[model samples]
Target: MELRNDPQSHYALNACIDKYYGSKGLPCLPYGGVQIRTSVIDGQIHEDVYEKVYFVARKYFIKYSIPIDTKNCFAMLSFAIGPNYVPMTWLVTEENESKFRVDNTTEAVVHNLAMLDEYLAGRLI
Candidate 1:
């Protein structure tokens, strides 16, 4: 993944999640995007990965009263801005949400990262 010019913001955000939830930080993909691995939960998958993340983020925003948009998913989480350029948001999949509830945005992110890490490490079946 292409490194961001300023990683501090993303780092800070991850730090926030770690502080609240415990480390399971997000991952930076080759194209500078973020993704979380999830499995079937209650026999339902949200379908749209980006949308699901946005929805969860919206819930977080409403709960925390933070001003953020689902549009900035990549920038805020991965520090990688897309060509179109939009607000910062995080992307999550329905399968993932099934495994972990997004009651806490930071914790959700951390859980996502931990899941991804496990998948990469071949710890997840």
Candidate 2:
């Protein structure tokens, strides 16, 4: 089933992303999921991060026997972390741009990317 179409699965994926991303005190279940924005300069880096995060999420889902399609889940994950599909103004202004880059480069983000790198490289699997 598509994660975006099923409310339960959508919330589950959102919670999984949020918890793994180290977001605290945020809504446990966001109906439409959360959006993480990035500046133009950091767009590629955040894309790479989301790729890693998707693989990590896939691994966890398989371990837990979650019956979600890989492609669909990855697409949903992309929408959640990618700077697209939201208001362009979210990343347009110079002030928000810097903050967006900073938010995307947090220590937690770096660590998740690194860990997923190892996992993908057959070291963490």
Candidate with maximal lDDT = 1
Q: Which candidate is the best by TM-score?
A: 1
Report the lDDT tens digits of candidate 2 across residue range 1-125.
Answer: 22333456545554455565445332222333233332244445231112212323332221111222333222311213343333212323544333221122223233443444344465543
Each model's lDDT comes to 0.33, 0.32
Q: Report the C-alpha lDDT of model 1 over 1-125, residue by residue, as the tens digit.
A: 22222345345443554454332232321222334333355897532222112212111211111112222222222211343322222333445435433332445455544554454366543
Candidate 2 regions with alpha-carbon error over 4 angstroms: 1-4, 23-125
TM-score of 1: 0.28
Where does model 1 exceed 4 Å of error?
A: 1-12, 17-97, 100-104
lDDT for model 2 comes to 0.32
Q: Residue 27 deviation, candidate 2, in Å?
A: 12
RMSD each, Å: 14.7, 15.3
Residues forming the 10-long window of minimal summed lDDT in candidate 1: 58-67
Q: Candidate 1's error at 48, in angstroms?
A: 14
